[model samples]
Target: MKKRLAIALMIGAGLLIKAQVGINMSAPQAILHVDGQKNTAPAVPASYYDDVVVTSLGNMGVGTKSPKTRLDMRSDDRQNAIGIGGTAQTASAAKAGALRYNSGTQDLSYSNGTVWTALAHKAPNDFVDAENPSKQSFTSGTQTIVTNWTKKTDVNGSFNAATGIFVASKTGVYIVSFTFSLASGTIANDSRYETLIQTNSASSATNKVFKCVGSYPGTNGLSNRVAGNCSGIFNLTQGDNITVNLNQALGTSKTLDADATLTSLSIFGL
Candidate 1:
């Protein structure tokens, strides 16, 4: 009788050890379940439902047993399907269809399988210089305006003060504009003073992007001031140089206004 009691006690202990545990639930589907849920504990590495799986690497997949990518989420709903926190990087690198945050620029950008573009509606790279040499002179033909613009509001450090050129650091469409007031000595009927937004990569005579002409009507006095502005959008590559040029028809010197608002160059990436 004692031997029979010992065997029964052993059987009871084995059954208790193999029993399923549940919390806030009467029946549990997994070995340990909380409120009929699976893998609620941090100690549990993974969980699965049919082919859908969550892996130890924190990758979750639907309709797949093994996730090939970081997050292989699949859904039929096109609009309300997926959301990502987005990877953060110090600088932009080539990535395909990736949404990421640029820490350097403090902006959000996305890759379109080829190039990375700023996610914001407007351009991320922008600069404006309004302080510089009070006056610049132009002789007869084309002459680069060597204005010493000291104050720079370059957001991306793309503008070079030494060269007086805005070098593109990112490839995109850029809108470049310059406004300057011109004062010439004597006014002739056909005298023309042209302000041009020129790029070094193209021929200025035919491939100039923007030009503004200040024509002397012969009625205006010698001290008359004329404001000229040139603005245009152009597709630019990285390291491309942009500068302002002035061309005068007659052999006379023209002065660019010293006023900050009157003479300035601005560039923005699109």
Candidate 2:
């Protein structure tokens, strides 16, 4: 009787252990079922038991129990979504294909798997209109004369009205041109007129980028007028200065024409 009782207890414990073990399901379909189903025995067709699956190569999938990759994540809403790490200590420390915003400079920087580069802002480009009627007088001999341009219209705020100079805000090639008319009440012989496009300084033989010369014959009683124009394309650097200058050897009384259209300078950047 004692031997039979011990045998019954051992059999009961073994059955309990076997009933608790199961795969692909919380409740045991069998002692160990690779494709455990609710109310059926483990079978060959794995598709019927799609809840959980582990292949021979150790690949696992959550939603897709048959993982193609080592760990394939499949979700309709989470397609191609990558993890975003907000800010980084330095650009060099960031891995390739990383993006971050720089709080110090407020710029967007990106890593190209090699190096990081900050996006640059576009430079200001502009067109400036010269003074309407620049008036000046020449005493005698070769002298640097100023075109007293009082009014200016600038597209990008690059021109100075008080100084009569165009300070370049960007580095590029520029088209510069000036037109002027000279009128003298008493015209004399040997009068020379020169229109000069000067850079950084007043008109001089060394500083003039463009210059035009013409001889004006004197007129008696009538106003003797001489028109001159000069233009050129110049490569300018930022902070460079540009202005139009007049050089004249008018014997005594020669003045720049006060006509708005006749005397003006215009500049544009390409």
Model 1: weakest 10-residue lDDT segment is: 42-51
**What C-alpha lDDT do the candidate models reach, one value each?**
0.62, 0.64
Candidate 1 lDDT by residue in tens digits, 1-270: 999999999999998866765555454433444432433333332332222344545565553435667666443222224444456443335456677765434566778766668786544665655455557666666657646776558887877765677877766688888877665366555567787887765323334447778776555555555677788898776656788777776445666666656677888887
Error of 1 at 134 (Å): 3.6
Residue 204 lDDT (model 2): 31
Error of 2 at 95 (Å): 8.3
Candidate number of the best TM-score: 2
lDDT of 1 at 200: 61
Each candidate structure's TM-score, on Cα atoms with residue i matched to residue i, is 0.50, 0.52
Each prediction's total of clashing residue pairs, residues at least 3 apart in sequence or on different chains, is 0, 0
RMSD of 1: 12.0
Task: Quote the positional error of residue 13 for candidate 2 in Å.
Answer: 43
